[model samples]
Structure formats: C-alpha cells, structure tokens
Target: MTLRADAAGRERDRERTLAWLRGVSGELASATIKRLEETLPWYGEMPPGRRSAVGMVAQAGISSFISWFEDPRATPWVAADVFGAAPRELLRSVSLQQTLQLIRVVVEVVEDRAKDGDDVLQEAILMYSREVAFASADVYARAAEARGLWDARLEALVVDSILSGEYDDELPSRIAALGWHGHGEVAVLVGTAPRQLEVDTLRRTARHMDADVLIGVQGSRLVVVIGRATPRDDTPDGEEPVSFMTIATALEPSFGEGHLVLGNEVPGVVDASTSAKAALAGFAVARAWRGAPRPALADDLLPERAFAGDPLARTALVQRIYTPLKDSSTELLQTLWCYLDTGRSLEATARELFVHPNTVRYRLRRVADIIGWDATHARDALIVQSALIIGAMSESAATRRRPTRR
Candidate 1:
C-alpha cells in the first residue's frame, strides 16, 4: 500500500511538470526559431512558408520531449514525431547539414530551459537529442539513395537515345542534367559486354583518368562514347585532341575478351552519333578480320565494313583518302598506284613511271604529304589499294552517267 501511494504521488508530480512544459512550449518554440534565424544562414534564407514548417517541428520537439519524459520508452516515437510535423518539401529544400543545425539549435534551447529540472529529466533530453540526430541522418540517406536511382534511369535513357540516333532538342538539356563533363571530341567504342560488368568500376576508372563516358549495354554488346572531362594539354589552340586509341587502350579492361572497335573521333558529344554509327558498323564486321587488333580502329576496318555492305565505310574510303589524292595532283595519285601495284618497291615503281628511283622516292614522299597515309607501310598499302579500287570504280560510274561529250 505504501508503494502504491508513492506511485500515485509520482504520477501527480509528472502531470504537474507536463502542464508546466505545455504552458512554456510556445515560448520555447519561439525562442528556438529566433535562435535559428539568428544563427543559421540557410534557415534565415528560407521562404516564410518553410520557416513556419520549421517552427512546427520545433514545437513538435518540445511536445514530444514532454511525452518522452512521462514515458521513457517512447524515445523512438518522439524522434520521428518531430520531423512528422515538417512539410514534405522540407527535406528537399533543406540539406542534411542545415537540418542538423536546426536540431542543434532546438536542443540548445531545450537544454538551457530544462537544466534546472531533475537530473533524470536532463539525461532524458540529452538522449532524445541523440536519437533525433540519427533520425535526421536516416531521412537524408534515404533521399540520396532515391536520387541515385533516378539518375541511373535517366542516364540509361540518354545512352539509349545516343545509340539509336533518335534525339530531340531536349537531348542537350538532358545530357547537362546528367552532369556530363565532356565538351570536346567524342569517340564511340564497341565490344562484347563482360560476363560480370561493374558499372561503378567503369565510371571510377574514367573519372580517375579525367575522362567521361556514356555507357550502354545492348544484349551482348557494350557501347561507350568517351570524351575528355576537361580541356587537354595536347589539344592546345584547338589542335586535334589526344588520339582516341590512347583512351581506348586505357578503357580496354572494361570490356570482355572479344574484339573491341573504336570509331573515328567526332567534334563533340552531339556529333557522337556519327562516331557511334561507324563503331557499330565496324563492330559488326570485326570478326571477319582474322588478325584484328584488340581495339581495332573503325577506319582500319573500312574494307570489312564495305564488304558487309556498309555504304558509309565505302564513302569514307573514297572521300577521305581517294578524292584528296586524285584532286591534289595526278602525279601523287599515279605514284601511289604504281607503288602499291609494284609491292612498294622503289625500283619497280620508278621503272613503271620511267623515272629515276630517287624521283620515285620523292613522289612517294609527296604522296604521303598530300594524303597522310604512307604507301611504304604494309597496312597503309592495303588502305591505299582499297581507296584506289573504289576511286577508279567511282570515276568509271560517273563517266558512264555523264552525257557523251560530242
């Protein structure tokens, strides 16, 4: 009976304390908001409606603490209740650091006012404040996770648009929204997707090398359009950017074991569709080249692409290599033709041209200066031979189409 009386008396004391706390709750909430406005720059900058929402949270914290003191086991409920009074948009408008500052300001006000209370009440306030801090972190962590997922979906959409070459005016804005840092030349790389692709690893690798990429996985194929994340020293005065082959070499480990193909470089990300088309076309026919390099250049596979009926490859060969030489000087063209036909032999080419071997050397060097390909190199010889065949055929077709000059 004595114990029961003690319990009943304690309950009455709690009821009296709770009434006092409720009476001063308004004053405590106003003081907390005043402290926040004076201390936190972000809080002071908040719009009036959000500030009111913040005030509601401060008031809710005071009420929740009173309840928590009455029932010590209500710690979890009290912590969440404080944030529940805040508007939904509060989480978006306010950063976690700012939210933490708000919590600190309110806790300071509560601690200052409640310090004169019994030791038990003061300890409860301290513990409750800790719980609130953790709960605030949880809220922001969840928001960050949701935002990451949304960005991933948006990135996939952007990559799909690039691959399909179907773009609208909104594409540039969407790319910007993805935080793409690339602003210079862009090249596309195509290869078989790895069995266990780690996308985060790929992105980290690119970032480490100061490059950016738009990655896409299409069935067994993996496509990446890569570019410099910042201006490169190698590209001073708008000179050609670092060779895409060097970038491809760095990224080769990201792909599977099969053949990888890198497209010709384009001016920028918006022009990447041109590079992507060439990469895709080259990748399709890469298997036909028995000795293809691991990261074969798209232009190097032009013959294979042309055999596979890729008109772009044929046009590229004729326009870039053949037309330039044919229009510059017939001597450069004839010397290149004779050098390739004579198996790159200086003496044989000179015999065919009825000139000294030294003159033939001069003409071959002139051809290299006119068209960047050196006919002496075996690979370049193959390219020159293909261009000559295509160019000759193109001229014959044009002549047949022309009205007979009478």
Candidate 2:
C-alpha cells in the first residue's frame, strides 16, 4: 500500500511540473530569442525574414519539449517537429555550428526558467537538447552527401561536353558553377585508366603543383584536362608557371601502364576540344611506336597518327613542317628531299645536288631551324619524310581540282 501511494504522489508531481512548463513556454521562447540576439552575432546579422524563421523554430522547439515531456516515446519526432518549422533555405544560410549555438541558447533559457521545478524537468531539458544537437548534425550530413553527388554528376557532364566538342551557351556557366580555377592555357592528357582510380589523390597532387584538372574516365581511357590555376601575368617574380609537360610527368604514376599522350597546349578551356582531339588520336596510335616514351607528346606521334587516318595529325605535319619549309625556300625543300632519298648520306646528297658536302650540312641545319625537326636524328627523319609525302600529295590534289584552261 505504501509503494502505491509513493507512485501516485510522484505522478501528481509530474503533472504539476508539466502544467508549469506549458504556462511558461511562451516566456521561455521570448527569452531564448532575446538571448540569441544578444549572444549570437550571426543571429543579429541574419535578415529580418530569416530571424523570424529562427524565432518560429525556437517556439516550435519549446512546444515539442512539452509534447516530449508528456510522452518520452515522442523523442523520434522531436527533431522533425522543431526543425521542420524553419524554411529549407535556413539550412543553407545557417551553418551546423550556428544551429548548435541556437540550441544551446534555447536550452539555457529553459534551464534557467525551470531551476525551481522538479529534477524530472531539468533531466528532460538535458535529454532534449542532446537529441536536437544530433538531429542538426544529421540534417547537415545528408545535405553534404547530396551536394557531393550532384557535383560528381555535373563534373562528368562537363568532361563529356569537352571530349565531344559540343558546346552550348550554358557550357561556360556550367564550368563556372563547378568552381573551376583554371585560367589561360589548357592541355589534355590521355592514357589508360588504372584498376582503382584515386581521384582525390589526383586532385591533391594537382593542387600541390598549383595546377587544376578536369578528370574523366571513358571505358579504358583516362582523360585529364589540365590548366594553370595562376595566370602568367599573376605569377610571382622569378617563379615561372609550371609547364603542362611537367604536370603530366608528375601525374604519370597515377595512370595505368600504357602510353600516355599529352596534347599540344591551347589558349584556353574553350579551345580544349582541339587539344582533346589530338590527344585522343595520338593515344589511339601510341602502340604503333615500338619505343614510345611513357608520356609521349601528341606532336611526337604525328607520323603514327597520320598513318592511322587521323586528319588532324596529317594537317599538323603539313602546317608545322611542310608549309614553313616550302615558304622559306625551294632549295631547302629540294635538299631535304635528296638527303632523305639518299638514306641521309651527306656525300650522296651533295653529289645529287652538284654541291659540296658542306653545302648539304648547311642546308640540313637550315631545315632543322625552319621546321624544328632535325633530320639528322633517325626519328625526326621519318617525321620529316612523312610530312613531305603528305604535303606533295595535298599540293597535287589542289592542282587537280583547279579549272583546266584552253
């Protein structure tokens, strides 16, 4: 009989405490808002509309606490009931830390007001505050996760657009949204994709080198569009910008075992399609070169790419090699033709041109100077010979297309 009486008395005390909490809930909410304005600088700085929203949240929190006191089983809905009062944009404007601060202020106000109440009221305040803090963390964590997924999808879209050479007016805005830090020159690197790609490591590596990259994986191919994070004019004194070749060399270990091709640099990301095209073509034919270096330049693979029916490589050879040589002098072109035809023998070339061996040597030096490809080297000899053949064919085709005169 004594145990029953003790239980009945405790229940009556709980009812009286619940009544007192309900009566002072309005005063507690007002005090919480006043405390926030005084103690939290962020709250004071918020726009009037957001401040009102925050007030609504605080009021709802007090009401939810009353409901939770009546039934402890309502703990699951306490977070939803309190946070659901605010607008979705509130999450964006108010950081998780700030939300915790708001919770702390509300808890302080309730604890101060309920000091004279029973221990049950004080215990409920502590338990409720703990639950709300965890809920705020969960809300922000989910938002971050959703944001990360959206960013990955957007990045993939941007990379696909670059590789396909397709663009709309929105492409620039899309890149801007991705927070691209690249400026000025851009180059594309293509290689085989590794078994397990470590994207974050690659990004950290790029950041350390003061460069930026847009990475993509298409089947077996891995593509990285690299650019200078700091413009040339912005470079500090005596510190030159890191060259794309150096960046490529640093990033080479991240790629799978195969020939890695770096396209020629272009003026900007808008022109990256040209670089992407060259890199793709070079990568396709990289295996044709038996001794190709790990990070072989697309320009170096011109001969192989052209033989594989890449028109861009054919045009590059004609423009960078044949046009310059032809425009300079016919003698230089004729000498080069003879030099290669005679298996690169200076004596044989001199005899064919009816000149001294010294003249052939001088002309070969001019050829190297004009085209930047030294015919004396066996590899460059093949590239020069291929350019001559393609240039002659193009000239012949143009002549054949001309109108015949009577």
Candidate 3:
C-alpha cells in the first residue's frame, strides 16, 4: 500500500511539471527569439519571413523538450520535431556555426528557467542540447552536398550549350553563376579522356599556369576551353602573344593516349562555340593524319577536315589562306602556284616567272609574312595547295551563278 501511494505521488508531480511547461511554452519561445535577435547578428538581419520561421523552430524546440522530458529515451526524435517546423530555406541561409549558437542560446534559456525543476529535467535538457547540436550539423552538411551537386549540373548545362553553338539571353547569367573569370580570347581543346580524370586537379594545374578551363567529357573525349585570366610578362615585346597550342602542350599529360587539338582563338567566351566547333571537327579527323603531334593545332588539320566535308574548314581555307593571298598580289599567287606546280623548286618557279632566284626567295618571304604559313615545309605546302584549289572552285561557282550579259 505504501509503494503504491509513492508511485501515485510521483506521477502527479510529473503531470504538474508538464502542465506548467506547456503553459509557459509561448513565453519561453518569445524569450528565445528576443535573445537570438540581440545576440546573433545574422539572425537579426534575416528577412522577416525567415525570422518568423526561425522563431517557429525555437518554439517547436521548447515544446519538443517538454515532450522529451516525459520520455528521456526520445532523444532521436527531438531534432526532427524542432527543425521540421522551420521552412527548408532556413537551412540554406543559416550556417552550422550560427545554428550551434542558436542551440547554445536556447539551452541557456531553458536551463536557467528550469533551475528549480527535478534533477531528471535538468539532465534531460543537457542531453537534448548535445543531440540537437549534432543534428544541426548533419542537416547543414547535407544541404552543402546538395548545393554542390546542383552547381555541377548547372555547369554541365552551360558547357553543353556552348559546345552545341546554341545561345539564349540566359547564357551570360549562367556563366556568371559559374564564376567564370575569363574576359577575353577563348580557345577550345579536345583530347581523349584520361583513365582517372580528376577535374579539381586539372583546375589547380590551370590556375598554377595562370590560365583557366571549363572541362567537359563527351564519351571518349575530354574537351577543355582554355582562357588567360591575366596577361603574362614573359612574352617579349613586338612578338605575337603565346599560342593556345602552348597551353594545350602544358595540359597534354592530363589527357589519355591520343591526339590533342586546340582550336583557333575567339574574341571572348561568347564566341567560344566557334572554337569548340573547329576543335571537335578536327578531333573527328585527327586519326587520319598519322604522326600527328601530341598537341596539334586545329588549323593544321584543315586539309583533313575539308576532306571530311567540314564546311567551316573549307570556308576557312578559302577565306583565311587563299583570299588573303589572292587579294594581296597576283605575282605572289602565281609564284606560289608555279612553285607548287614545279614540286616546290625555287629554280623552276623563278624560271617560270622570268625572274632571278633571289626574286623568287623575296616573293616567298613576302607570302610567309602575309599569311604566316611557310610554303617550304611539306605539310604547309599541302595546306596551301588545297586552299588554292578550293578557292578557284568557289570563284568559278560564284561566277556561274552571276547573271551573264545578254
């Protein structure tokens, strides 16, 4: 009879304490919010809607503690009950450090108010605070992981749009979101994907070299868009800027065993699609040319690309090499045509032109200065010959299209 009476008495005491806690729950929540605004600068500056959500979390935390006191084994559910009251955006805006600070503030308020409560209530408060702290960290870690995945997907989308030569008004905004630092001149590089391609390592390597890249993997190929973040002083004055091929050479080891091609420079990132198209076209036909350099220029593969029916390569050959020479001097064109016809013999070219050998040498030097391609090399001679033939064919087609005199 005596044990029964004691058990009944303890039950009544617990009921009374729970009733008091429930009555003052609103008061406790208000005090916690007030304390948060005063103590936490981040909390004070939160927009009104978010601040209200945080207040709801604090209220729910106080309410959950009362429930947890009834069952000390309910530690696992306390964090969920408290945090679930807040909106999802709260987790994104509030960092783990700020969350821990909030936990500390709420614990202090609860502990101070419950000072005269039973020893079990005080012990429960301490245990609950520890659990909430760890739970807050877990929530924040998951949010960070989710955000990382989202950014990676966005980056991939932007890269895909650039490669496909598709553009809309949102491209600049998307690129800005990726924090692209390149301001001028962009070049695309295509190569075989490495066995273990570590993107972060590639970025670090590019940064060390004072360059930047946007990397993408398409099946067996790895495409990197290279840009100079800042100018380098190593280049001597009066010389052409360092070529993209040099940058490609430095990044060669990052790729798998296969040919690497760098496209011609474009004005800016907005023009990168042109460079990407050229690089991709060259990569498609790169295997046709045996003994291709490890880091080959896309322009160097013009003949192959043209033969593969790449219109850009054909147009580029006509305009860049042939038209420039044709518009510059007829003598230069005739000398080159004759030189190639005679199998690149200076004596034969000079005799055909009725000029001295030195005149032929002077004319060839002038051609080199104008087009930047030396006709003496066997490979360059082939490119020149292909450009001439294509240029003549295009001119003939245009002539036939023109309305003839009646």
Candidate 4:
C-alpha cells in the first residue's frame, strides 16, 4: 500500500509539470527570438522576409520540443517539424553556423526558464538541443551534395562546348556560373590521359600556378584549356607573367606517358579553336620527329605536321618562313639553299657560290636574323628546306596558270 501511494503521487506531479510547460511554451518561443536578436548579429542583419521565416522556424522548434516532452517517440520528426516551417530560400541565405547559433540561443532561453522545474525538464531540453543540431547538419549536407553533382554536370557541358567550338548566346552566362576566373589570353594543351585522372589534384596544381583550366577526356586523349587568372598588365612590379610554355612544362607531369603538345596562345577564350587545332595537329604528328621533347610546342613541329597534311602547318611554314625570306632579299634565299644542299659545310657552300667562306658564314647569320631559323641546326635545316621547296612549287604553279599574250 505504501509503494502504490508513492507511485500515484509521482505521476500526479509529472502531469502538473506537463501542464505548466504547455502553458509557457508560447512565452518560451518569444523569449528565444528576443535572445536570438540580442546575441546573434547575423539574425538582425537578415532581410525582413528572411527574419520572419527564421522566427517561424524558432516557434516551430519550441512547439516540437513540447510535443517531444509529451512523448519521446516523436524524436525522429523533431528536425523536420522545426526546419520545414521556414521557406526553402531560408536554407540558402542562412549558413549552418548561423543556424547552430540560433539553436544555441533557443536552448539557452528554454534552459533558463526550466531551471526551477524538475531535473527531468532540464535533461529533456539538453537532449532536444542535441537532436536539432544533428538534424540541421544533415539538412545542409544533403544540400551541398546536390550542389556538387550539378556543378560537375555543368562543367562537363562547358568543356564539351569548348572542344566542339559551338558557341551559343548562353555560353557566357554558363561560364560565369561555373566561376571561371580566367581573364585575357587562353591556350590549349593536348596529351594522353592517365590511367586514373586526379581531377582535384590537377585543379589544385593549376590554382597554385595562378591559372585556371577546363579539363576533358576524349577516348585516350586529354585536353586542357588554360587561361591566365591574372592579366599580364596586372602583375606586380618587377615580376613578369609566366609564359605558356613554362606553364605547360610545370603541368607536364600530370599527363600520361606520351607526347604533350601546347598550342599557340590565342587572344582570348573565344578564339581558342585556333590554338586547339594546332595542338591537336602537333599531337598527331609528334612521333614523326625522332628527338621531340615530351612537352613540345605545336609551332616547332610545323614540318612534321605539314607532312601529315595539316594545311595550317603548311601555311604557317610558307607564310612565316618562305615569304619573309623571299621578300627580304634573293641573295639570302640563294645562300640558304646552297648551304643546305652542300650538307651545311661552309667551305662547300662557298666553293659552290665562288665566294669566300667568311661571306657564306656572314650570309647564314643574316638568314638566321631574318627568318629565325639557323641552317646549322639539323632540325631547322629540314624546316628551311621544306619551306623553300613548297615556296618554289607554288611559284611554278602560279607561273603555269598565267595566260599567254596572243
């Protein structure tokens, strides 16, 4: 009879405490919002609409706590009940840290009010606060995961558009959305893709170099479109902007074992197709050169590219080399031709031209000064020879096509 009486009194006291908590739940929510305005500066700075949304979330949290106090089985719905009260935009404008601060303020207000109540009330507040914190974290984590997947898909689409040279009006807006920091000049780098691509590491490396890249993998090939994060004019005093070739060399280790070709730098990203074409052409014919460097400039492989029937390479050789030499002076052209025909021997060249060896040597130096290719180097000799042959053939063809006077 004594044990039954004690149990009945305890149950009556619990029921009375529950009644008192329900009565003051509205007061608790009001105090929590007041405390949030005082303690959290971010809450006060929010726009009026967002501030109202936050207040709704606070009121919802207090009501959910009361429901949980009545029955512990409602623990699973505590987070949903509180957060679901706010607008969807609230999750975006309010950061996770700010949300936790709001939670802290609510718990503090509730704890201070329940101080005079039984120990069970204070323990329930603490447990409820912990659950809300975990739920907020889960909500933010899901949002971030969804955002990451969207960014990856958008990035892949941008890279595809760049490689295909298909520009729509929305391309600029899309690039801006991707947070592209590239400014003025852009270049393309082509190489073999590694067995496993470490995309994050490559991005980190590009960031360290103060550059930005758009990476794509097509079959076994990898293409990276690089741009300067900082413009040339904006570089600090006494420091020059890094050259594209130097940048390519630094990024060389990221590629698989094969030829790495760097295209000529273009004016901007919109003109990147020209550079991409050159890099792709050089990559195709890189093996034709016996001693080509691992990271070879597309311009340096003009002869090999021309042999592979790349019209751009052929035009570059003729326009950059043959035309300038032929236009400058016929003597320089003849000297270069004789020098190459005589196997690069100064004495043989001089004997064939019936001039002093010193004169032949002087003319060869002039050839290098005018056209930027030296007959003494075997590779350059081949390039100069190819240009002369193509230039002569074109001249003969033009002559044959001329109308004879009747």
**Tens digit of per-residue lDDT, candidate 4, span 176-277:** 787888886889999999998988888788888888888878889988988999888889999998888888888888899999999999877777778888
Model 3 lDDT per residue over 1-406, tens place: 9999989988888888888888888888888998998899988888999989888888888888888877768656666888988888888788788788888999988887889998666777888888788778788887889887887787788778889988898998987887787665789999999989988888887777667888888899998988777543444587555567777887888999988999989877888899999999999999998978988889999999999999999999999889999999998999999999999999988888899999998988999998888898899988889999999999999999999888
lDDT of 2 by residue, 170-260 (tens): 8878888878889868899999999999998888888888888888899999999998888777888998889889999999989999899
Model 1 regions lying over 4 Å from their true place: 1-10, 47-50, 64-80, 84-89, 231-242, 403-406
Range of the 10 consecutive residues with the lowest summed lDDT in candidate 4: 70-79
**Of candidates 4 and 3, the better by lDDT:** 4
Could you tell me which residue pairs clash in candidate 3?
Answer: none
* lDDT-sorted candidate list, best first: 2, 4, 3, 1
CA deviation > 4 Å runs, candidate 2 = 1-3, 236-238
Error of 2 at 167 (Å): 1.6
| Per-residue lDDT of candidate 1, residues 39-148 (tens digit) | 98887787899989888988888788877777778566554788887878988888888888888998899888877876556777788888888888988898899988
TM-score of each: 0.87, 0.93, 0.84, 0.87
Q: How many residue pairs collide in each prediction?
A: 0, 0, 0, 0
Native-vs-model 2 lDDT? 0.91
Worst 10 residues of 2 by lDDT: 72-81
Report model 4's TM-score to 2 decimal places.
0.87
Clashing pairs in 4: none
Worst 10 residues of 3 by lDDT: 230-239
